[model samples]
Target: MKFYNRETELEALSKMRDLSFKEHSQMTVLTGRRRIGKTSLILESCKGTDTVYLFVNRGNEAALCKSFAETIVREFDIFVPEETSFARLFTFLMELGERKKYNLIIDEFQEFFYINKVVYSQIQDIWDRYRKKTNVNLIISGSVYTLMNRIFKEYKEPLYGRADSLMKLSPFSTNVIKDILKDYKSDYSNDDLLALYTFTGGVPKYIELFMNQGATDIETMVDFMIRSESPFLSEGNILLIQEFGRKYGNYFSILTAIANGKNTIPEIEEALGDTSVTGHLKRLEEDYELIKKKRPIFAKEGTQTVRYEISDMFLRFWFRYFIKYNDLIESQNLPLLADIIKKDYPTYSGLTLEMYFRQKMMESHEFRNIGSWWEGKKSTEQNEIDIVGIYADDKRALVGEVKRQRKNFKPELFNAKVEAIRKKALFKYEIETKCLTLDDM
Candidate 1:
């Protein structure tokens, strides 16, 4: 439960703090998907400062105002009069902020805009009126991708030019998770660590589940996670719906289709029976931040040939195994679920190996850029390339494929990746080619 490793991010926070010590106020926007540990990073950053942590919820303006006032009162030891409204509540805080410097973190800030649309204007007014002398370091954090993006970056929004620094707290890299497990004396092997990355992709909360379940290996962890009543069993449902709203069911189906190898739009639509998924795909990529539209390596700017893939690892695994078997799980058909997991786990994990490879790439200093590349030339001519590592300069690149199976990467597998990369025009760039197994990586 204690913070383990966020040294680089903490250093960035320290820089922000130093900047806030100047005459002007400072604002940092921390954004990421749900459960990526934005709140934890901010709390760690505000360790010794005069910090007020206000979390906005799904409630009316008046309810949020009351909660804000109470938190401020408790945090700063401010005295409140008999009664107050939302405007008066913030006005008092503005006055106090002008007098003394403090760190204020507003978590789940998108909820405020939904509940009361004018809260941003009110804060902007107070900020414009009195921010010069406040010296307050404000960091607003949120998990809602579209709303939070609009709040900070949209030109028409009230807080458009307000941010001094932006930090998107991504999931921890595999090295960070390895450090945490080592610190906790968890003694898991490299393969076990890779397996964890396969399933969770370094989400701290999910890692903690395996830790708590005493799962020293992947099999036990899967057994613990796929149960009907486990916290993580239904976690993707809650997290995805929170980000994407009721439209999540459609997005989930699309993701499931993609994970199960229905890569093309037509293929995914036929598989899910959701002919309206074209519109759903647009929102899923642009708004919800769930899946990404990946073009081939040499795609032109106006290329319409692209593939949709789940952008998050846990969701990828969730849709692949858990969501597809939701009925059996809900009906408490444990034996059936277990049998499916046993039968298809390697197949599922062979796909998840891409995530584990990406994690390793992120941990390595050699690769400045890492992503996947594929070709969309043929209908049944499906070409797949797993991991692409671009070197530090624009001069060089490394094209590679990853397999999680125990067997060696045969000559055919390597040749297929090479052929696919050539079809993608990667050879035109003079890129190096490498075929990697889980062991080679």
Candidate 2:
């Protein structure tokens, strides 16, 4: 967990910081979901430099401002005796930036909405008036994805288009995770790696917690989760409740349906007692970015060949286990819940293996398009190809079948899937069929 990956983000942040210090004020906005290490990235960018870091906590606005004023004085050696208003303190900092350069990082910036709804407009006004004269490297970050995007990207919002650079931090890549697993457990198996990826999804905070506690395998990971005071138990609820707010019932139901394998619109609709879920699904995909809409490769735009999958590995596992077995958690039946998870981990982790390989192929960057190909209108899912990669050169394609072990891969049958897809989708190219297994980790 020693600050893996994010080299691109660090470079941009450094450039912006240097530009702000040399020229004038430059605003950098960072947005990502909870525990994506926004604060860590910001602080890392400010290493060996003078910085005033402020966290926007939910409370009285004046009290928050007073606390920030003290940090500003202590960090920047300024004479802010007591500024009770954030607007006044912010203006003071901007004015001070005109004389001296420093980094100013504001974490949980979206919390300003809860503290003082008018803070956004106030900052916008001050920023517009002082940006040309100030030399502060202002970095503001928020964990609430929807709110943060709206605050910065919406044309009508007060802080709209104010950022000199906007960066969204994603989870660590498959390579980073592998390096981390090697560091923690050198003898880790493919299943062990998959378990870590399946549960943590390369989220930094989760990786730190599990690896630091020596829970690098499936059983140990689940054991750590079900223990008292474990954040994994209610993490899914805590994460989405803040985003979905009062209208979370339907969203949670839709996500649960997806996690439980009711992947199609019709299936999810049937699971929800035939309630219309188009709007909710749209928001989940486009706004929340929780679930993904998938179609068979080479499928037409309006084709009736769509499926839905939860995009987050951890959330998918959480809904499948934590939400589905909430009765056990609520009743304090931790042992039984852990037992059920152990019983189901193999079947559950296999589906995650498919996703893992897809990501692995994506990370290769050799393919122009990558997806699975399955026949439409096939009620029996017998004719499906696991991984399909259309190379950027347009002369070759990769058709892969994923299995836990290479021994389970039937070459003849996989070749049959290759032929079917060739006649349907990749007839013009040479096909290379591969068996993507855990060893590929």
Candidate 3:
């Protein structure tokens, strides 16, 4: 598929390149989760330019330096002495930048932690010595969020405060996905569109995989992704293990519980056999950003009522089926796994539809705040509202429930819940109630 969005990011990167030449060497740090296209964006920005690209793979430090030295020699077309470490190789590049201006892209930069822990300090020393004299636009990209944050965002780290620009890449928006779907299949229905969003979550790499195999429809996409050779089966396992480190077991258990609908603190802990998960959950939310903590709309700051949801759409779907049915996966029963997901998809997609409308509302930029409201202690099926939006000026509110079909909606019961929230919290504003289905998308 063609590059859909990121016009603004490309513009900013180009502007930063100009600024780097005007001032001195400018360091740019780009971070996002795995498969979010950080590397693709960087490479796209350097088309037809003098660029040296280095991938920091997990291996011997000296061997990696030799590889990078070869790349530098190939890109610059000059004879150079061999270097044994990144520190020496990088110092050579910085000195070379004094005369030749080029783009220096280092991808998977966090892997330096495994190759050589002192690489950060070495680069910091080299950068400080040559920054004012060098003219290179140095861009470093990483996928591991925690280690990357520690390397640049924390105060004590050597690279802290060194970046001229820091950008966290986000997923493609709803409209971008719709346009891409139309580009591939002009006759696509809202169900196919929702399935694409539900499965890929607008992440470029996953979407590319699906589209490459001609998996434009729901059944085809499910078949391609759930097979034995498919990458989706092990995606969550590999990526999160890299992020959470050695104590990944506990984190995985907590995440799996949340994905399976054990949302609340107590419920997750119980599902994990009473494992102590409070600290783990906090890290997952505030640090890893894999899960989001949600409270009811108009809820107080000190409210004890809280719920957790996996923030990544693809991972949410993966954990719900791929992790939950490890027995089927390990036995290579992929047909059964696909069947199970097909059986459960209707109920599952209904929940995803709620998120679709919530995202649609957010895209409009019309709401000051958007969330669902539920009663505190006496909460049950009757008191839950799937979506609530307070208008930007606080004059109107949008309250609604989400369902896959119109016949499944209960208008009278929903109005009763709307009245309850109106009297309890939103009494001051005019409210609009809606039942968002697939057609709304």
Q: What lDDT does candidate 2 reach at residue 153?
A: 93
Provide the global lDDT of candidate 2 against the true structure: 0.90
Q: What residue runs in model 1 are displaced by over 4 Å at the alpha carbon?
A: 184-186, 274-276, 362-376, 379-385, 393-397, 416-433
Report the C-alpha lDDT of model 1 over 235-256, residue by residue, as the tens digit: 7877877776766677777888
Q: How many angstroms is residue 34 displaced in model 2 relative to the true structure, after the best TM-score fit? A: 0.7
Residue 210 shift from truth in candidate 2, angstroms: 0.3
Reference-based TM-score, model 3: 0.98
For each candidate, what is the lDDT?
0.76, 0.90, 0.90
Candidate 2 global TM-score: 0.98
* Candidate 3: 10-residue stretch with minimal lDDT: 372-381
Q: Give the per-residue lDDT digits (tens) of candidate 3, residues 330-406.
A: 99999999999988888999989888888888989999999999987446989999999999999999998999999
Model 3 stretches with alpha carbons more than 4 Å out: none
RMSD in angstroms between candidate 2 and the native structure over all alpha carbons: 1.1
